[model samples]
Target chain A: MYFGGSFSRGDFLFLLSGAVTTLSITLVAVVIGTVLGVLFGLIRAGAPWWIGNTLGAVLDVFRSVPLLIQLVLFNSFNSMLKLNWPTFTVGCICLGIYASAFCTEIVRSGVGAVPQTTRRAARSLGLTWRQELTSITLPIATRIVFPSWIGLTLGVMKDTALVLWIGIVELLRSSQIVTSRVQEPLLILGITGLIYFVMSFPIARLGNQLEKKWGTQ
Target chain B: MDYEFQWRPVLRSLPEMLWGALQTIEIAGLAMMLGTVLAIFLALAKRSGKKYLSLPADMWIETARNTPALFQIYMLYFGLGSLGLQVGSYTALLLGITFNNAGYLAETFRGGFAAVPETQTRAARSLGLGAVQTQWHIVIPQMLRAVFHAMTNQMVWSVLMSSLGVIVGLTTDLTGVTQKLNVVTYRTFEYFFVAACLYYLISKAFTLSARVVAWRLFRY
Candidate 1:
């Protein structure tokens, strides 16, 4: 009967909802991460001497450890500190923090790639440091970093699966539930893999196109 | 409320954790070696210009890249088991990682291959070197050197990814052993912290050695 029975309509809907949850979590984390990443990027690249160096060193710890460990540690931190937030909030926080570290590096390098002559030109034209960064450095840097940003987006989407470790029941967890109930692990997992492929392929191909286009300029 | 930090349990379990770290390295090293070999064939298949070879290679790379490594491992371990094909946890983890690594590395190698200009291939042919001989003697070496740093990054990835083995009831690796220890003693912070440190140390060691190796091999 395990092999004989096919998935019901409800099963398909449950899996689709899981996909929605996965996308939602990824979307929120990307927004939070991008904002925090830009702030940290500016701090590392533009702030005063000790501040920048210290922030860089601190973020390196996040970069070095695995995200799974980061999730567990964050859970412990939440419990120990008695914050008692929901698991989804904790998942979003951990992923946001994780993405911030990498994005900080991405942003810093993107900004760094801007030529010094361009910055000086802005300065000579009476632009303040803030104006220079916003009008001149950031626009050029953003184009340079767009391709890497696409790669990062794809990465964070896939990594949302790890949140299932803390029992958030996203796409992968949904499939696991179905497989356990149906005794059809291969079919469930195959469908899950296909879903992820559908989601990520276009982004990756777009990144390639962007790289070629931006690379020429 | 003050949450007092304790260190003794973590200290006492240091040896077990160290052994776990060794197993982590063992799995990652083996996967990298296996994956790199498979990746060369994959890269060649993509470059072969035949529809069958290139299409399959592209599919594998896209599937491996697009999906989470966890999905790949689950399909191999649980999915296969349900389909009546049982593999041990270690083999499943290794194969999953190798599949992922080979896919990513195949792309990295393709970039490296492209970096070697077409004129070089033409020159090799003009010099009467056979195709295999040309690739073996010239293209592969340059490709290795060009992509050496990317390979090092992938090696670090494999090590970190080995931590996912804990999900599949793998008990021998660092994260698995840490989880088991966490169960016995609820010193979650201390044990996980130590495991993180071990991972960081392993990655640092690999990265440092990679630089030295790069300097030596690529000096020409």
Candidate 2:
């Protein structure tokens, strides 16, 4: 009896479109998050003490605050500042910013996990700081932190659902709209959950595979 | 740009904000207590050798971990209502938060179980203790230590996530009141700043309490 009165093919399509939007947002956010995370990690790991401390404080504040609050704050701020950025853009920025905090710590830990000997060897080869980081440090660190990084990436994808609360029309929001019409909450939720699982399952499996392959090395 | 900072609106809303903070703590405490009990069962079930016992537990953990807590709350609150269950928003919110908390807490306890040395468990068994007795007396104490920090981390997360219950129309929680104030006063910074401070204080208090408990429990 689920989806009984008001179900239609269009509702399924809307849900599918919502999944697409979620995926797109996650993809963009993850890309931005990883790049910024690496930059912040490098700064924290190798920069001057003042620079490192500033980035460290930023990470702490960002990580401590809830993502929901950050999203809402950013959305309101965007309007207040007259930035005229789309809600989706604000959603992506907030997500990327939030994810980057965790990612920075992950990347910093990876960088720290690299041995002092390696750094010394790179310096002995007359490589500059940037050169040594690119050639020696990051490669090893990436391998070392692949598991946790992948875990954080999956976390980002899941956290994107929060954007729906701000009216982003992501999967859950789409499902809510459909459920309101169809009056079959369980079935709608089950379907929406299945959609999320389908999206998340492959990433998680890939993460596991990466962890198994690189974690031991 | 001419911007005036308004303190009066925020001041007027302070009492409601305080009430919201109380509600936030109430939801968090209830959810954490329920979650801890559920987590113990989940940890045990996952560690159980039988597939029948372990598979469902594993599925629950994976699903909860992979999806957003927001979606889970929506599914419970709005999705359930659309199914004709007719539960109140607060009941739905609590159920959703407890379910998600149990999922994460299960992982924490599982980590603790993994950290418990097998030799200790074996020593207890050789002393003629049954599985339950060995678990209760020998394994659990050690496991609790390993899990303590992780549980504290989960508590902080649960407090933050409880904010999402506002979307489901639970008007008593901190996030709920913030949303209401934001709509009415259009004072984003003032309202969110207050809410943020409240959350920060609560999380700090939780962290300090956990530290005290860990010191007393571990004694080293």
Candidate 3:
């Protein structure tokens, strides 16, 4: 009724549900991306030269290419090989893997940003390499990288909109569907953009605050 | 045992893919150029220390930074069309990317400007240099040097985001062209794989050129 048409309460609910779906996809992908990224970061940061270099090269490919292209190619490869996975599942996996590339770099650089003297100081205290990393280096590095990690979280939340291309009915696609039905693209898309802005503003604000508080450390 | 990799289709489609790559570069280059100009103004607005100017710039930066590039492009392409403000896919995509780029680069430049202490500005004023003169002669060169790496990253991001043009009916970019070839040949893997390689090469080229430019500009 707001735009001189029958914009029902159900339409709002539909978009809300779509927002829930977007959050779910972002949550699932972030969890998977974090785990894979941590593993890759550890390897790239501390593993043997050959192992680290090989993993680095693979991650470089993923990071360099566009996520949209990766999603399309992965979806096609899955169907071509008769994998027949659901679109949502394929989207989650592709997005998780795509995000893992950036996360790996963030983690690697975070760890590198930790001072070498700190590591050596821990070692001279008779700490093992594992203890030196977990108790000393990683804690400091994680603190340093917290702002970047939050930035990445906001990024993944936004990138979830791309899953619409593969027919997953997330928030952006939900708006698109409504736009098609109601013939009010501007109103629908504006509301959708506002929804996204609402979803992301708090996280970005928190990132800024954290950077302000801990960045000087 | 029967699945053989064919380079013939890839070779046959090389010219088309190359043309597509050129289009990709063209759009990204133009968007970056436009974005940088807008970013300068936005950054200056944010630094202007007045509520009216800063507030709108802040909203634009925050909104553009928060939303996905795809959403921004979709609004411009589909949403604007339905509003009867139709534009070509190329213009829609270009405007969308430039908007996002301006938001991001404004933040980067703002940070760079902040890193230059207020003491320098006061000193410039004491030396009878006007505000614009101080900014141009002292702050901007240093800020550009500080943000050269960030600008390169944004360039890569612009190139990658251009791939989304395929979804918006852009058939002239690399991804768009690759999608067309894939439909004709049913060589989805080969075509997309080659396209990915082309993207990788483009990014690497940008990285290398960025380093060279940084060296030349910041040799001091």
Candidate 4:
């Protein structure tokens, strides 16, 4: 005599909707995160000692703490302020900024990988700082940083699953809901895990392949 | 005039939270140690060139790599429970972190093993050593040395994942304790903020100590 085994078609659709929400959140967050990260990365790279470290200390908090705690803290702060933003809005905002903290480091490292001699030579050739960044630095750094950026995108997708803690019905939460009614956790959770695997595995393999191809050249 | 924060509740329960942080470290340390042991076998299985050995290893590694940690925790706590195997919350959380650690460290070890030159294995095999003995003596040590930095990274990730114990119904861990406090006090910001700071401090301590250890060990 086993447990309740009533996983319906509607339950599967619910999980897919959750996966869709997860993808949307990742897309928005990456857009917001990568832009802020590039801007912050450039500043961190070019700025002086005092300013950069000061900025770093603030962003380090995001990198250090678990995403769950960050989500809870941000949600709490949101409610405390009486703004009453939708949970989805709050989730996207929190995840976007959380990703920026990591993206800043990636982009800064990307910028740092551009050889000083190369930058100096760009300057020595009468290119302004802006031109050097646009022409000499950005192009090379993009090639070096492309694979890492893809990894970050995948990371943000997985991290989006944490948004369910703040009451969003993302993939994990949706599966949890179905499992509650269906009484088959392994089946439901296995399907949820497969959804994430299907979503992530291709991108991860691409990143690895790109890393290998670019690394040798 | 709203949101007058109360820090007294958090202040009063500082001892409890501190204890919770200690448990967090305990989980992370235990998971990293056990995970490293598991990762060695998984890595070897992955490279064993035998279908039966490598296939399961590949599945474990890939499944763990692809899914969210929260889902993995759910699978252990709820999924396995449905199968009539009752794992305690703490045990589930511990195993979940260990599972994650082993999955990632397996990949790192595979790369590290590859980087060990074939001649070293040949030299060991020539010295009247069997295959397993050669791996244990020469190959594993070199692999560990090469992947030491990556292992330190996985150690810190184990710390971060320890925060998930609370969600899995273990109330003795840092995040769980903090959430418990918040449920009573309704001062979500205060309790979670403190928890967040503690997490940051723990991770920083891990990386700093790892750097010092590397400095000491790799000075040559």
Candidate 5:
């Protein structure tokens, strides 16, 4: 009613629910992605040259290619194979792997970024290799890579908008539905963008702050 | 044993896909060029120490860095269309990506510029170089090297971003053409799979070419 041409409060609620769905997808994907990434990254670091490079190349395809393409391809595959999973599940599967691909790189570089001398020092000090990793390399890498991980989480949140293509009505799609019915693309899209900005701004600011603070120390 | 993929239709459309990819590459390349140019100014403005100048730059950077690129493109195409603006789909996508690139590269440039020691600029000036020459001959080379990794990431990102053209009614980009083929042939997996490989190759080509260019030009 305030700035309206028949966009009801119910429409706004619908959008809010869509935002919730986006958050849910992001949360689950981040967890799954992080775990897979950590595991693969560790394996890649110690892996033989041929295996590591091949794995890296395969993962690179996921990272370099567009997520939109992956979504469409996978969704189609799902139907073709009669997997018949819901769109949400399919989205999560693709996004989880997508996040894992990038996360693996982050972890690899982070592990490499650990000073070799420090790792050697730890190894020389009567600690096992496992102890050296846990006590020395990993902690430092985790701290160093923490900011980027946050950035990745925020990225997954934004990428969730693409799921609309597969027919899951997250935030952007909700706005699309509203606009189609109510005929106010700018107003609705602006509101949707604002919602995204609000959700992301604080986290992004935190990432920047950490990058500075942790980077210096 | 499952849903058979009909690749014949997809194979027949290779020329169309190639043309669409050419368009996508053209937009991404232009956006990167323009975005880098704009980012230089924004980076300067942010460090210019004037609130009036930096405030607007800060807002542009923050809004762009925080929002999803899809919505930005959507607004440019659909949102503006509603207002009778009627921007072309290709142009709108280009503008949106350029806007994002400028905002992101501005931040990267700011850091890269800071990495260049202040003494170097003074040294260039003392050697009788003009302001423009100092920036071009001295500052930019070092800054580009410092930020080279980030620059390549954005270059690859621009290619990845071209896929968003589908939602914006772009029929000429690789993804757009693929989506059109998808709707008609219902060979969703086959078409998108080919499109995906094309995208992978294009993005790989960009990164690999960038590496070769850097190797040829950059030195220790």
Candidate 6:
């Protein structure tokens, strides 16, 4: 019944804090996911048959399953393993693992898009496998996959919300807490949606711009 | 640290789990159907020369596209509940799926519509067809051809997003059943493995069917 009370000072701080937490988790997860994605992408792209297939299977299992279930499993597994990890750390790890699957696909596609001639030419120039990958293949592949990478990043940002189910005090969780305290659901939810909109809009806009630019190139 | 892995409890839950899988498919199918219609309308409206109509349609599409489906469901289910306008979890789930699907489908259809040649629309108009007639006879058919693959991608997304319904208390879906079984048996690996298999099978079926439709419709 406290309609106007939800807009009070403390509730705003609480929601803002939640937004910050969500952003921090997403940022850390994206960085780790991108690194893992690149490694997995290399395995999928240029590794030997057994290695590539093994990595491919790992990516497939992660991608095919729902994030909620993955989050739950990892949270429990962390406890069973007695890792003493914080829930936020576990949330970040789960999100990173999930994001890496999609990123690996994007990165692998990017790497594959690099013409075979480039690799052959690099080899003819006496480049080592590591040198060829770092100097030639990865650069060209990154250009090709830039748009998809951006799109996946946006997806990862939005997915940070899923951690709320595991008791992470993300934006959605904050809104729930505020609703309980002040009992103004519409305003709180509306504000939460707006906050999410703010966080997501720039990334999506950047994704579109990159796609358009890269499409022309 | 040696805990016995039991298959008996998971096996006992198979029938109910299968039932939940069916419900997940049913919900995804219905949502996709409804959302496609909404997408067509939004796509066409956005393409209409009228600025007012296109502007709001653009805003709706952008908003829905930018946010996560989980947030939308949470907003509809819990957010609306806070306003004293409680909706059934299933209804809220459907609304969320439909909303997300519509946004994605609008983009897909819009891309398809863009792929259609302007000359085709002009030719239809020159033949004395009205705007509506031009859209139906000249634009839609060609657009559908271009959108076939994109539509299949959206269907995959819808199937995946349907898993979020479990969070809002809609427990009659595959993810929900998996979660419940996981809780009871602590058989994480088995439950998630089975759920992933179900998702892959369903998505593969959709992909195959879509390919067939694409072949038939756009065969030269």
Chain A TM-scores for all candidates read: 0.95, 0.93, 0.93, 0.95, 0.94, 0.93
Mark the 10 consecutive residues where model 3 chain A has the least summed lDDT. A1-10
On lDDT, the stronger of 3 and 4 is 4
Q: Please report the candidate that would top TM-score against the real structure.
A: 1
Clashes of 5: 0
Question: Of the pair 2 and 6, which is ahead by lDDT?
Answer: 2
Off by over 4 Å in 6: A1-4, A48-54, B82-84, B127-130, B180-193
DockQ list for all candidates: 0.77, 0.60, 0.66, 0.77, 0.79, 0.52
lDDT of 3 by residue, B1-220 (tens): 3345788989998999999999999998899999998998899999999999999999889988999899899888987787789999999999999999999999999988888888888999999999899988988888888888899999999999989898888999999999988878888778888999999999888888989988988997
Q: Pick the candidate with the highest DockQ.
A: 5
User: In CAPRI terms, where does candidate 3 land?
Assistant: medium
* CA lDDT, candidate 1, residue A124: 99
Task: Please give me the DockQ of candidate 6 compared with the native complex.
Answer: 0.52
- Candidate 6 C-alpha lDDT tens digits along A1-217: 4344537888888999999998899899999899999988888888898999998987877766668778877876776677869999999999998889989989999988899998999999999998998899988888888878888888888888889878899988888888887777778888888998998888778878888888787
The regions of model 5 sitting more than 4 angstroms off are A1-4
Which residue pairs of candidate 1 clash? Answer: none
By summed lDDT, the worst window of 10 consecutive residues in model 6 chain A runs over A1-10
Across A35-114, the per-residue lDDT of candidate 5 in tens digits comes to 99998888788789788889899899998889999998889878878888999999998999999999998899899899
Q: Write the per-residue lDDT of candidate 1 for residues B1-220, one digit (tens) a residue.
A: 5788999989998999999999999999999999999999899999999999999999988888999999999989997897789998999999999999999999999999999888889999999999999999989998998899999999988988888999999999999999999999899988998998998899888889989989988996
**Native contacts recovered by candidate 4, as a share?**
0.83
List pairs with backbone clashes in candidate 5: none
- Residue A119, model 3, lDDT: 89
Question: Per-residue CA lDDT of candidate 3, range A1-217, in tens?
Answer: 4444556687778888999999999999998899999889988998899999999999888878988888888998787778889999999999899888888988999999988888899999999998998899889989988899889888999999989988899999998777766778788888889898899998899999999999775
TM-score of each: 0.97, 0.94, 0.94, 0.95, 0.95, 0.91
Candidate 3 deviant stretches above 4 angstroms: A1-5, B1-5, B123-128
Which residue pairs overlap in candidate 6's backbone? none
| Candidate 4, CAPRI quality class derived from DockQ | medium
